[model samples]
Target: MRVPVVVKVGLFALAVMGIYTYYANSIPQIQSALPEEISLEAETVTPEQLVRVGEELFKGKGTCEVCHRIGQVGARAPDLAGIGGRAGTRRPGVSPTAYLVESLLQPGAYVVEGFPNIMPRVDRPPIGLNRSELWAVVAFLESLGGEVRARLDDIPKTAGVPAGEAPVAELKLPGDPEAGKAIFMGKGGCVACHKAGPLGASPVGPDLSEIAKIQTPEYIMAKILNPAAMGTVAGYPAGVMPPTLGQTLTAKEYVDLVSFLLTLKGGA
Candidate 1:
């Protein structure tokens, strides 16, 4: 069928416009609407300059490496490998940036479960950090996941003891499994580890819901009170566990903690 020239051209134009509209609509609207992840590349500062300024306060004035590790081998501090992703999940009620800032400024608030609350609160005098220096350490910690892109020169190279030096003796404290749960979740902060059925636990540390099935109450008590004696595993970091919890806890608290820990069971 021979169509009129003007009509033919009009139909062709309409078909083109319709095809354009269909394809446009078919494109994912969310992709177009969503914002790209902005690169947080540092401003143009020399690598040496960044390290000097960053490490000066961090390792020297700040003394971060005293407890924290950069390359997975320091004493009493959770290794900072993949900490940029972990800090958010490990400690609830904290984002990556906010968690980093809060940790530096207030070290004891939400401790890395199983570790002692020994990290003196940085908010107090004689050991406080101003805002900028704290953030710089955060930036450096956030940067440590991959190859250490920054020069950690200021971080002293002294080799720390492979494991914590705390002595490990039989747990003298006595408590029941039922009672231990109370002290654990309440006083001893045992909920930080030993999760079962979504009750209380943290992945950065060990799970104790099945300890009773595996180890005796005395063994469990000794291990809990003296984590250094227990040693390390794949997920759990070594030496970071506080071996002095026995000293800090009362006999009753110890009993209660041990009692609660024994309640953990495998296979539900």
Candidate 2:
């Protein structure tokens, strides 16, 4: 008996789907890993514990291991071996601990010789770390070859963000600052390079707490829409910010983020 054309077609279709399913399953899947929140109870954490957590952050959330190496030469960043001892000498009048904080917060402040300035502030988004986590990273770096004297106070708190609140830019722009903040910390990922508070204190938040007070409203708007045209900050890398930011965000998101940024008076 001859198979009906419809039945043969159905079988072929099923076989094609089966092969597709098999092929798809055979291919390895890729997924981006989001960093886990690192929380340390400061009152109860010990120096050793801090170092361990710091190591974890260095390896994980901090993403330092991507460009840094413990004892080997880093093609991207500097070899961190004995960095604790050498950190003080990196800059005159800057102590080992102070230098570490500065590097984590203001990566462009000091670029290592022969290395391009590309290190992002660990306290900012993507790697957004709170004060305690930043302290842990510093302690971890110090543990390599120097004294782990990094203190919690070394990290400064943003003005209005200490309470997880956005600053009162009180601008006439019609956008929700709170919603914009969510975009900053969420979709916009602006917190990665700029801080509008809420990242939790000094060295931990990437330190752009006073953007509104320092920048004019017109400049802020233009900067967000066309960063390359606005020009880079003195110490930061040129073209570091995404030029596609305006394209990526919805109009409301862009407005909200701008309104939120305008409110960041850094406690006036």
Candidate 3:
């Protein structure tokens, strides 16, 4: 049977369209339905008030948008879209908001899986945050995580000590921003994943444009040593960040590395 050329063309086009639609929608839907075996407490906030406050805090003084991604703008970090979902499977027993608080206060405590542990410690900066500012930043991060699968309430609010309060620092190495840059790229191994100015690092992680202004030293160190402990925050996959490479360095090295990290502050 000789089919008309137009008929054959039309059928081919329809088949192609059908395949595209199925791949685009159905695959995702089925994957969503599949059991990922995740465990994460959902987040709860004041809604409009928290979101508005978080938006301003994140974009403004927080300067989180510089390295981290929110609703467009910056890059060098993972997209915040559906952070709640990512955290659930990746960080079991961790709340999205709590995870954010930990990340800000201790960037090194729990490095995301698959990514290099490169986020400089926030402690390098002298900007010690008061209680209110800390809460505000945490709130903003939680908002980004959005409503998770399990109710956040299910997870204990006090999963760990409040961020920015840990006495993790023992040595006193006066930080030099200039020297810190060298240490970051050199011994610290931070240059492997983080980019600074013309010095480009790997895209597998976030950038260090103006991290000093956004994070506290305590937060930075925690992220360095144990990012998994921080869980998932700002929707970055908790498992994505590696644990702090503390075992790799000595006490003095830790102090020196931290001092160098502090100099990375100020707007990029």
What are the clash counts of all predictions, listed in order?
11, 5, 40
Choose 2 or 3, whichever is better by TM-score. 2
- Model 1 alpha-carbon miss at residue 40, Å: 17
Candidate closest to the true structure, highest TM-score: 2
Residue 6 in candidate 2 has what lDDT? Answer: 44
TM-score of every candidate = 0.35, 0.48, 0.40
lDDT of 1: 0.49
> Over the stretch 1-268, how does candidate 2's per-residue lDDT look in tens digits?
9976545543543453355345433431211133354556436788999999999878765667655788986234688999999998999999999999899888889987766544655554334566777888999999888999988877776300122223222225667888988998889877666645566342322255655433345556666666677544433466767777666776677667767876775543
Query: Residue 224 of candidate 2: its Cα lDDT?
Result: 68
lDDT tens digits, residues 1-268, model 1?
8865545533443453355345433431211111212111335654444435555555654545555666676355677768766766756676666666566555667767656544543322222333334444666665555222422222222211111222222222234766666776766765665465456757656555444433334345446556665545444567766666655666556556655664554455
TM-score of 1: 0.35
What's the C-alpha lDDT at position 17 in model 1? 38
Best-fitting candidate, scored by lDDT? 2
